[model samples]
Target: MAVKVKKIERKKMPFLERIYIFYIIAGMARTFRHFIRNLLNTKNIEFLEYPEQKPEDITPRYRGLHRLTKYESGELKCVACDMCATACPAKCIYIEACEVEGSKEKAPKVFNIDLLECVFCGLCVEACPKDAIRMDSGIFTKVEGKREDFISDINELSSRKRGDF
Candidate 1:
């Protein structure tokens, strides 16, 4: 048996439609009309003075700045198990563990996180067994002059308070 195939036909647009200038002009005119209408109506003008005024509410699930939690005894809760550093996908975390003077538990002598390298995936926080690390401080990350400024030290991370959003 022989199969017959039909040729597909495509409708060609008019010369005016083929040249996109007319469509472009029509779109621009529509945009201009909306702009004029919005400009005339004061209620349609939606502008916020940022920097001077921050948004009143931030989402509760927003992962902002990282903070190291402390124990009730005023000591750092991190046992320096390297779990967070190991779990970091970006390898931004760096930790140096040292034996505590009198305690059997090891403490982090130096803990640093390179903000530039961090992807902010919250994996480090999830890997921490002692609940030492958290990203709920609500502190906004600031622009720094030097690369070294982006590397947050153990003290800075531990000092962060749960800020009001």
Candidate 2:
């Protein structure tokens, strides 16, 4: 079946509208208004000194940095199933499985998540059958220098404690 297409009349743009003069002026005016308001009331402005000042608004469900959970015996909860890596949409998670010395289960010898590439979607946490990985560190990922600094290794992830957050 052939679909009937509707022909709509196009409005002719005026010289000022075509040039976006009014839109630009409106934007500039809004910017200047905010600037003037801020300038006049500097004390009213609230700026959180991040890293030093923890945001009070961070809810319980806030997905922050990634961390690996440990068992009561201090061993990592991860079983090297590669579920998290498989579920990651960004393909940021990397895991090298090693056979545990005394157990039949495998453990991650080199579990690493590149924070730079991570979307912080919490999919890895959900996909894990062991509940090994979590994004509830409450500490926001921050890297100042070196791209390699953003990669969180197994040791770093496991070392993160609940109190640290």
Candidate 3:
């Protein structure tokens, strides 16, 4: 049975919520803490110049930018079971599976994820049963002028994971 939800009447916040001094104080405190820590231990902070000095040693479990995985045999690892597509809250992932000879499951013939459509919420990564998709590889692909170029294939995504980028 469906329950009807009443329309909520939103009210203006109190003067504190509106002015938000508490939030400012908290942020300032955090910033001051970081500032003091950095001042004390100059080499302790992990910072990169970005685009110029990228972090060379990211943790293995670090949640990286994004990646579509592949098997070591040069075959696509994604089974195209639609888990990623379904799991995506943005509904950005699309898959068209095709059968291979002697294979019980179907592989993606046309697998596309719209970066413009993706929130990078990591739902797709968590949904992958085979660990065939991961965003923890420490590699980030650049978006191009052509929207179609952002629709990366398993092969292209896999090649980057293959180490010779």
Candidate 4:
């Protein structure tokens, strides 16, 4: 038995289409129409006066920044299982676990997340079994001068409180 292979050939475009001037002119005409329409009717303009005005509301589901939750007793909710760190695909999460002073559960002594490397996949939040981590603070990570500023420490994460948004 012999296998037969067919070679696929692409059709060549015409000279005018190859030059693309017609398409460019059509696009320019469309842009000019829009410009003229917008100029004639200023009401068609759609833009916010940012800095002076902000968007009304941020959706509850918006994943902004990471924050560590706490129990009512002021103790961290995290058991320091390192599940979140382990689950992070970016390897941006770092944790140093230590036994809690009075409790049998382990707690993170040094928890830091490098936002620069973080892809914001929300995997860390999902992997947290104790409901310890969340990305609901509604605070967008800011531009920092130094790379070191991007690494959020345990205190910064744990200091976030509910309703802070």
Best by lDDT: 1
Model 4 poorest ten-residue lDDT run: 50-59
Q: Which candidate achieves the best TM-score against the true structure?
A: 2
Q: Using Cα atoms with residue i matched to residue i, what is each candidate's TM-score against the true structure? A: 0.72, 0.91, 0.61, 0.77
Q: Candidate 3: lDDT of 72? A: 65
lDDT value for model 4: 0.87
Model 4, 33-133: lDDT tens digits are 99999999999798877534655676677787799998889888988899998999999999999997777889999999999999989999999999999
- Global fold similarity of model 2 (TM-score): 0.91
Off by over 4 Å in 3: 1-48, 55-62, 141-143, 162-165
Report backbone clashes per prediction: 0, 0, 0, 0
lDDT of 1 at 157: 95
Residue 136 C-alpha lDDT in model 4: 86
Candidate 3 RMSD to the correct structure: 7.3
Q: What are the per-model C-alpha RMSD values against the true structure?
A: 4.9, 1.8, 7.3, 3.0
Candidate ranking under TM-score, highest first, comes to 2, 4, 1, 3
Best-to-worst lDDT order = 1, 2, 4, 3
Off by over 4 Å in 1: 1-51
lDDT (10s digit) by residue, model 2, range 1-165: 999999999999888889998899999999999999999999999999887888888778889888889889988899999999999999999999999988999999999999999998999999999998888887884855999988989988998865344
